[model samples]
Target: MDFRFSPSDDAFRRDARAWLDAHPPAEATPRQWERTLGADGWIGLGWGRTPYGNRTATLTQQVVWAEEYARTPHTPPRLGHIGENLLAPTLLAHGTAAQKDQFLPPIARGEAIWCQGYSEPGAGSDLAAIRTTATRTTATRTTATRTPSARTTSPRTPATYRVTGQKIWTSHAHEADWCFVLARTEAGSHRHHGLSLLLVPMDQPDGSVEVRPIRQLTGTSEFNEVFFDGARAHPDHVVGGEGNGWRVAMDLLAAERGVSTLAQQIGFGEELERVLEEARDTADPLLRDRLVRQWAELRTMRWNALRTLGGGPDPAAPSVAKLLWGGWHQRLGELAMAVRGVAATAGPYDWTESEPYELDAAQRLFLFSRADTIYGGSDEIQRTIIAERVLGLPREARGQ
Candidate 1:
C-alpha cells in the first residue's frame, strides 16, 4: 500500500503549517484555548464528522495533524473522555440529520462539552446491570426512575429510562453541557439485550441537574458522582433503535477505542520526549535503553493508529495498542524517576515550579499511567481480546 501522502495532501500540510504560523499560540492562559480552538476549529485533533474531512481522509493526514499538534508548545483543551470518545461519534453515527447538524457543529467548534453517564455505584465493568430507568411520557419526553439495582436485570417501565440512578466516577460532569447516558429499557434475563443510550442536557438554568465533583488524588475532582432524580430527556434522545443500546454502546466503544488511540499515542510520545530532554543526563544506560525502547514502541503505536484511521476498522488491534501504551508509559515513568535520583520525588524546581507545565512530567506520567491499563479495559482484558480474536486461542470462562 502507498503510505506516502499524495501531492494534494502535501499541499494541505503546507497550508496547515502556514495557518499555525499566522495564529501562533496565545500567551494569556485564557486566550490560549480560544486561539487554538479558532485555529484548529475542533476541540480535538482527531476523529470528527469532518466538514473538511471524512472517514476517507488519508491516515497520513491524521498522523500529520496529531504529530504537529503534539509538537506545538501550545496547550490543547483538556477534553473529557466522554466528549471525545463516546458522545461525538455516537451522535454522528446514529443521530438524526437535524441532531447531527445541531450538535456536531458546536462540538467541532468547541462550543459545547459533553460527559458520559454510563457507570453507576453497582454497575461498572458489568455495565449491563445498570438501573437508571427512563419511562416515556409523550413522544418527546420521558422521566428517570433510579433505585439501586441488586439484581442484574431489574425491569421498570417501557419506553426507555426516566433516569433516576446515581452515576459515580463520571469524569467532568460538572463542566459538561451534555451527557450521553446508557439506561435500562427492558425487563428479562439480565441479558446484554436490554439497554439503551440516551443523550441528556445537563447544567440547565432551572437547577434540574445537580453535579457534585468527587475529589481525586490530583486535588482535582476530574471525576464526579452525579445523582439524577426525576431527570427528564426527550424520547428522541435515544441513539439507535429501542432495546439496541447494548449493541450501540459496543459500537460506540469500538469507535472510542479506535479514535482515542491516535491522540493518546501522541500524548504519550510527547511525555516520553520530555523525559528524554529533562532526565537524560541523569538517566543510566539501562534506563536510557528502556526509554529508547518505549520511544520505538510508541512510534509503532502511532503507525498502527494511523493504519486504523486510514484502513477499515480492526477490533482487536486497539486493545493491543492500549495495553502496550499503558505499560510503556508506566515503565518510562518509573525509569525517569530512577534516573532523576534524589530529585525524583522533589517538587517543582525554583525555576519551573511556578509554571503549570508538568513539573517532572515523568512523575506525573508515572502516577497517571496506573489508570491507563484500568480505564479502557485492563491489560488483562486486552490480553484476552488478543488471545481470543487475534491469536485464535480458546476463550476464557466468563459467565456470558
Candidate 2:
C-alpha cells in the first residue's frame, strides 16, 4: 500500500478542519455536545459523505478525518459508542430507505439516541445463546418475558421464547430512544442460525419497557439492565433477512474493531503522553524501562491502526492492532499506577497530594484497562481468529 494521502484527501482534511473552526460545538455539557454533534450530522462523516458512505473514499481521507477529529479539543463532540461505533455502520449497510430516513438523520443530527441490547445475563461472551424471543404477531412483534429470570440452559431450536430473560450491561439504556436488540425469531436449530436483529424503540407512551441503570465502580451509571415485558416490535423492524442477522452482526463487529481511524488513536495516544510526562519525574530505573516499553507499544499500535483505516482492507491487521492496543493500554495503566507509589488506593483524583493527575489517571486507567482485552472481543479470541483465518492454521475445536 502506498499509504500516502492523495491530493483530494489533503483537501478534504483542510475542509474538515475549517468546518470545525467555524462551527465548533457550543454546548457546555458533554451530553449536549453529543446531541449537537448528532444534530449537525458530524458524528459519522462516513455515513454523511457520499463517496465515503459508498466506500469510495481513499483510505487517506478516512485516516485524515480520524486524526483530525481526535486532535481537535473542546470543539468536536464525544458521542457515545452507539452513535460513533455500532448504529451508524448498521444503518449505512442494511437499513431500508424508511429505516435509514428515520434513523440516520437523528443519529447524524444527534436527535434520536440509541443503546445496545447485545449482552444478556447468561449470553454475554457467548451471544448466540440469547433467549430473548420475538414472536411474530399480527399487530406487532410481541415479546413474552422481560424480567431478570435465573439463567436457563441454552435451548435447542427454541420456539416462542417469550423473552423473560434480562439484558445486563446495556449502555445508556435509560436515555436512549431506541435499542438495537438481538433476539431469537426462529424455532429449532441451534448456533447462530435462528437469531434475528431488531431495532426496538425504548420510550413509549404506555411504559412497556423498564430500564435500570447499572452503576460502575467509579459511581457512574454508564450501563443498565433493560427489562422488556411483553414488549412488541413491528414485523418490519427486523434488520436483514431471517437467519442472516448473525452475518450482519459479524460485519458490524469487524467494522467496530477495524475502523480505529487515526483520530481515535490520537485521543488514545493522549493518555500515553500523560503517562510519559509523569514518568519523567520517577527515579526508579526498572519503572523507566517499563515506561519506555509502553511508549513503544503505543506508537506501534497507532501505526497499525492507521494502516487498517488508511491502508484499505487488510483483514489480518485489525485483530493484531486491537491486541496490541489493548495490551499496551493495560501496561501503560500499570506504569501510571507504579508512579503513584503508595497513594494508588485513593478513591478520587484529588486524594493524592503528589502527582495528582498522574495518580487519578492511574486509578482510571487501572479500573478501565481490565476491559480492554475483553470488550471488542477477548484477546485470546482475536489471536485464535488471526491464527485460523489469517494465518491459515488448523481449526481448533470450539469447546477445547
Which candidate number would show the highest lDDT if scored against the true structure?
2
lDDT of 1 by residue, 1-400 (tens): 4556788778767765776566655554433453355346534445544662223334466556545555566745455445644676777678787677667666655556788888888777567678887665533334455668643433454443466677878877877789888887675536476788888888645565788887654445667888877677767778886788888887877766665466666677667777788765753677767767877887777667667667775778678677777777778778677767777776744574665434445676666666766765667777877798888999776564
Q: How close is every model to the real structure, measured as TM-score?
A: 0.79, 0.81
Candidate 2 stretches with Cα past 4 Å from truth are 2-7, 24-26, 29-31, 38-41, 48-58, 75-77, 139-164, 347-359, 392-400
Over 1-400, each residue of candidate 2 has an lDDT whose tens digit, in order, gives 4656778888988976886777666545656776655554456655546322223344566667667777777654354557556877886787776776666666655566788888888777667677787766543334454458754444333232233347888877887888888887786646687887778888656566899987665545667999887666656667786667787777677767655535656766788788788777778899888877877876777666665665556667767877887787777777778887777776455554663433355687777877778766678878887999989999776531
> How many angstroms is residue 50 displaced in model 2 relative to the true structure, after the best TM-score fit?
5.1
RMSD of 2: 8.5
Angstrom error at residue 400, model 1? 7.8
Prediction 1 global C-alpha lDDT: 0.67
Clashes of each: 11, 11
**Candidate 2 minimal-lDDT segment of 10 residues:** 155-164
RMSD of each: 8.3, 8.5
